[model samples]
Target: MERLKLDYNILVIDDDKELCALIKQSVTKENISAEHCYSGADGLILLEKNDYHLIVLDVMMPGMDGFQTMKKIRKQSSIPILMLTSKNDSMSKVHGLRSGADDYLTKPFDMEELIARIISLIRRYTRFNFVDNHSQPLTYKGLTIDFDSRSVITQNGTFELPRKEFDLLLFCAKNQGRILTKQQIYEEVWGESYVYDDSNIMAIISRLRKKIEPDSGTPFYIQTVKGIGYRFNKEV
Candidate 1:
């Protein structure tokens, strides 16, 4: 049996207005609406004014760049996002995923392939994107974190956190119920062994607690072990 097709509104956020025009022209087909924004700021503004089923984002831009922009969008909507990048490096892909992009395609890609990915991502998330995906992360209470897309929803509201903070929080969440020493956390998130008297770990933890905890002083998710380190309360 043939599946019923649905119309999709796709917003492409890239600095190259010319490329945007080319994409709009190339991807023109029935049931697909493609709109372009010149910058991340413009994209955010347009999002407030309109609705979209998905987003095609470019990695490098004048101001916000793809990572930063993706974070902001994830804060509000779980709409599938496909990131475009000129750099084909593994690090770039990792960073994009860690920053909240659903999927990524290197630049100079075939328009046809791009279109297909869009359809696939939309269909999967729109219908079959379930909570049991195990890959998904959530706060026992109110927080929700989508690791694949690198987004967070807290009591305050949805926020796209900076890269370091995201890593810190993800590490904490993954290690819930286990006490992670400052040295352990520093190495895990920042990729370096801990040094004495350094406040880098404390700083990141403090900032993260403020964002996810209902009350930083009396944190519910991340608990202070006092003189040892911190741990995400598994009991929460």
Candidate 2:
């Protein structure tokens, strides 16, 4: 018998009650169930008590804020987190993504865009388990991706990566030796090419390299093809 597929449960942690309600209404369609927590502190409590597939977090909460909340969450789970902030500055995005957020969106964002990002993360985390004809895991050098278990074995360690990061690295690994432009990467990984934001891709790549490469600065697995795109080092 096949397991019945259920909608993904999402947690939204923000101080904006009205916006939370709006997001809950907007994303609570077909295969998504949205829940709200008015503050990061409250959200953490809910996190401990329940399971959620994705978290939509606000960066400017009253007390703990998104970064602090994310830090605590990372200590416990690798659930996909999409950070929302009013700040468009690069540093905020860097800090959020580096600390554990799977993606970031600025405030006053298009609801459609938010829904797209939320769905992308949920699908990657919950629905993906692709294998070739022989059901062999993908590997290069010491890195092995077990799609069945959603785990990766790297030179550093065998780790269960957050869904978005895993999918990003998997794509690069599979298409080794080919130049993948930002457009292609976004379209393939995000399922959209409209929002050409380099910060998000760069953040995920940075996080991936840290896990797999000996040194992120001198990456041996994925190389940036200056001015054009990235190439997964085929020689590896």
Candidate 3:
């Protein structure tokens, strides 16, 4: 039984040879192919040479860190990117998101969780491109969504969004002012028919808030409904 979807190639740019081998082995089980690069410059060169479905990059690298490489990549491609960082590093996570990473996973993460994130990111990216091909108007928070580009911009600045956050944001924006239950959101944004552990959705929402909200603690874009789900309070 071929388990992996085998739809796209994944490029992993990291200095850790063992981790890269682990990821390549794990991802290959899903029928997906992976390429590895130990240097930032090498990853850039590979990016120029091939088309990758997703990029899993490590934050702490020798010559050029993941952030710098991603920054450079953003100047060319909007491909989905997942960043790997040290555990509980809030500042690095923030900086990674701000630098156009699609998702960030801490080091020593569960392999299952990493695979789930990759799938979710790819699904969201595909959906956004679908909407873009149809020329849909995706607007929220006085910002316009560009499905083709996978980016959001305001008068203050423009930022690239990682896969799931972009889908979550567009989902909420498309349903502005309507409170959506967690299950509904999980099904839609995650593209999963089965129920997921709601904690993942909450984390995704939190990530989205931190990226778009002026203040994540006092968020105006995505608001919780206590026992319910969440609502995109565009009016707020």
Q: Estimate each model's TM-score.
A: 0.54, 0.59, 0.59
Model 2 compared with the native: what TM-score?
0.59
Rank the models by lDDT, top first: 2, 3, 1
Give lDDT tens digits, candidate 1, residues 104-130.
899989887887777766655554344
* Candidate 1 wrongly placed segments (more than 4 Å): 1-4, 129-236
Q: What is the C-alpha RMSD of each candidate to the true structure, in Å?
A: 13.0, 12.3, 13.6
Candidate 3 structure lDDT:
0.78
lDDT of 3 by residue, 1-236 (tens): 22445466899999999999999999888767899999889999999999888899999999998889999998898788899998586667656765667678998899999988777666556655766689675665556677678987754467788988888887776555445677667877878883658888888888777667777899777888676577777363
| Per-model lDDT | 0.76, 0.80, 0.78
> Please, what's the RMSD in Å of model 1?
13.0
Report lDDT (Cα) of residue 175, candidate 1: 51
Model 2: number of backbone collisions: 0
> Candidate 2, which segments miss by more than 4 Å at Cα?
1-5, 128-236
